[model samples]
Target: MGLRSLQGRSGLVTGAGRGIGREIALGLAAEGMNLALLGRHSATLTETLHACVRHGVKCVALAADVAHPGQVKAAVDSVRRDLGGIDLLVNNAGQVDRAEVPLWEADQAQWWQVVETNLRGPFNLLHSVLPGMVERGSGRVVNLNSGFALRPDGRYTAYATSKAALLRLSDNLAETLRPHGVTILDISPGAVATEMTANMPMFADMVHWGSIPYLVATVVDAARGRLDPLHGRFLHLGRDDLEALLRDAELIRERDARTLRLRPYGDEDPLAAYS
Candidate 1:
């Protein structure tokens, strides 16, 4: 389980102010990794920072909105200056749509805002963080993906669409960064109970909500390069069998599974990558 020598590795996690981000940050710290925490809430970031500090790992908390490219650049610069360099990047900041309405009936501004946060936020972080990782020839990026990305849903069009786009981005980045020794992974944390989900009416009848410890550990493994064989893949903590995925990575790649891809009409299709 302890596949990494993380005593001096530095990482930055967005949305580290609360929820699963805070938990993952704390888990990383416990594994002896130094961290820079980014979020819009200064107070919550401080609270997380304080907790991580108790683990005796170097930690910094910065208040910044992930949706803004300018803020992301500035925050990443500070992370570089303070942490020496980033070995891991976790794009976890995201927002969900409030209403379960059809796209035609959705609030335009709110719809776009969810896209800005869920998709553009990750893009902003990757834009700012990739240069350094590429230059250094080592880094891992974990995007907080969702089940919505893999399925078509009538409700929360913005959330589903944005997550789907993020998954595609992760796949593209993984291929583009392979030669540079950087890896990008997409993982859904599953139905973890949180303030955000508790408010969503979609789960009103949900009998079971899962824990995030497994998700956090999987991320840690990804950060450690233990899961590099499955890079460019999408994993769901609630649904995926990690051991099987790791063991059958060759089969997974041979079939091009666990990735977002367009289905070809037939073997004669001209645009199909598989063809």
Candidate 2:
């Protein structure tokens, strides 16, 4: 579908107050999609909402902590009441531990906080939105994932574990949701220049940065169902070639590539066999 096909579609984006979330919200708005922006801070969300409105599409801002079920429900309900049922959902709100310490050295509270925000946040939003999408029989979901999900990162245990689990969540849901005409994609935006990355000491002197435009374009394409054949797969904007991937969509589906799975010890491996 062309970008114009997105016009009049309704979407809800978490963490729409700033950074990549803000960019995604504006990009969707540019496609003429109505937006419901959810963020922890009203001030920043208002800024994004105003910018999106300039695109001549309907926009609303709601302050809600994505980790809180009550807040997410209320926020989603308001979006349905105002902009209509959400056709797209972006799980963009995430958090990292304040300190980049190993699991044993990490503060308990801070570690759990990161886990809850990154993992539970998406769970809450999905729980609140999936029923409506299933009832409608058509919807798209994009979960902002990371390389840490595929590779083991001991330094940021909580963040890495949360993201890894989220990728699995996307994969598991895809199998069930596909028959309902819903698509779920786990997209890794990579190491983009964002407030979250800047604050991490590990990336203090990082030179190379991922392209935000590429990431946003990938997201838009996924939202438009351009990559539906590869649904429930992990996509890395920095490393994976989108055009090439699209061309190889059939092979990807046949081989179940780009998904997190247990490496089979041999051809007889039960897990791999089942897959």
User: TM-score of predicted model 2?
Assistant: 0.95
lDDT per residue for candidate 2 within 1-275, as digits (tens), equals 22555898999999999999999998998888899999999999999999999888999999999989999999999999999989999999999988878789999998988888999999999999999999999999999999999898888899999999999889889889989999999999989999999999989999999999888888888888898888889998889988898899889988888888778888887777665
Q: What stretches of model 2 exceed 4 Å from their correct place?
A: 1-5, 267-275
| Candidate 1 residue lDDT tens string, 93-198 | 9899889999999999999999999999999999999999999999999999999998999898999999999998887787789899998889998989877888
User: Can you tell me which runs of candidate 1 are displaced by over 4 Å?
Assistant: 1-5, 265-275
Model 1 weakest lDDT span, ten residues long: 1-10
Error of 1 at 72 (Å): 0.5
lDDT of each: 0.91, 0.91
Provide TM-scores for the models: 0.95, 0.95
